[model samples]
Target: MKKITTRLATMDDIDQLADMFDAYRQFYELAPDLALSRQFIRDRMLGSESVLILAEDEEGASAGFCQLYPTFCSLAAAPIYALYDLYVRPEARKLGAGRALLLAAEAHALRNGALRLDLTTAKTNLAAQSLYTALGWQRDDIFYAYSKTLAA
Candidate 1:
């Protein structure tokens, strides 16, 4: 495993981050489109709509990335974050890059006075589940997640 350094992503990282984002979407059976991926990530990062973290290898190349969105918890009366995306390159998995990115996000959330961090993964993603569980993330038994697509 190579040494992994995690840091908040900047505009300079857009190209690599976009490539990784596209690969991530493809891993979940989505079609590949570097243009769309680039634009989406750029917009989120530039607009301050999300927190982006990038994991760099020893050579300073991007090895993985994670994106988090801020949200509020009315009941808890505190800020929270939705870790919407977490992806490590195929060659980078099990190298601790993913864990490093996750820990960085946790630290960011805590620094912002967030009370919790939440995320969801496909039901078939056992590897992700295992990683999250190993990081002390427990499965929620309280409520179900429901969504409806408003656009095509």
Candidate 2:
């Protein structure tokens, strides 16, 4: 097993995080947009609107990252964290980085008094689903998700 460590990402990590983030978006069938990826990450980190947990090996090379958004779970009337994005580089898979990232994210949320952490994934993404299940993340069978885009 490899020794994977995770920490809250800082501005110093923006470049590496953007590179992996671009790959992650492309994996989901989105077009590659390096500029957009960089700016989005920069905005999030600069504004403190999101939590980006970065994983690395002992060598300090980037392994992967997961971005978390903090929000309130109105039904529970308490703060909660939405794990919006989680990605592990293709070559870094099976190295325990993903699990480390998840564990770190959970710790961050819990330390901040969150009620629970929530996440969603495509039904076809069985690999990710498996990881989440192995980490004790339950599927939301009790509710459906819907969204609409408003034209600006």
The C-alpha lDDT values of all candidates are: 0.95, 0.94
Which candidate wins on lDDT? 1
lDDT of 2 by residue, 1-152 (tens): 56889999999999999999999999899999999999999999999999999999888989999999999988889999999999998878999988999999999999999999999988899998999999999998989999898993
Q: Count the backbone clashes (under 3 Å) in each candidate.
A: 0, 0
Candidate topping TM-score: 1
Q: Give the C-alpha lDDT of model 1.
A: 0.95
After superposition on all C-alphas, the RMSD of every candidate to the true structure, in Å, is: 0.8, 1.1
List the candidates' TM-scores in order: 0.97, 0.96
Per-residue lDDT for 36-144 in model 1, tens only? Answer: 9999999998899999999999999888999999999999998999999999998898899989999999999999999999999999999999989999999997989
Q: Which stretches of model 1 miss by more than 4 angstroms?
A: none
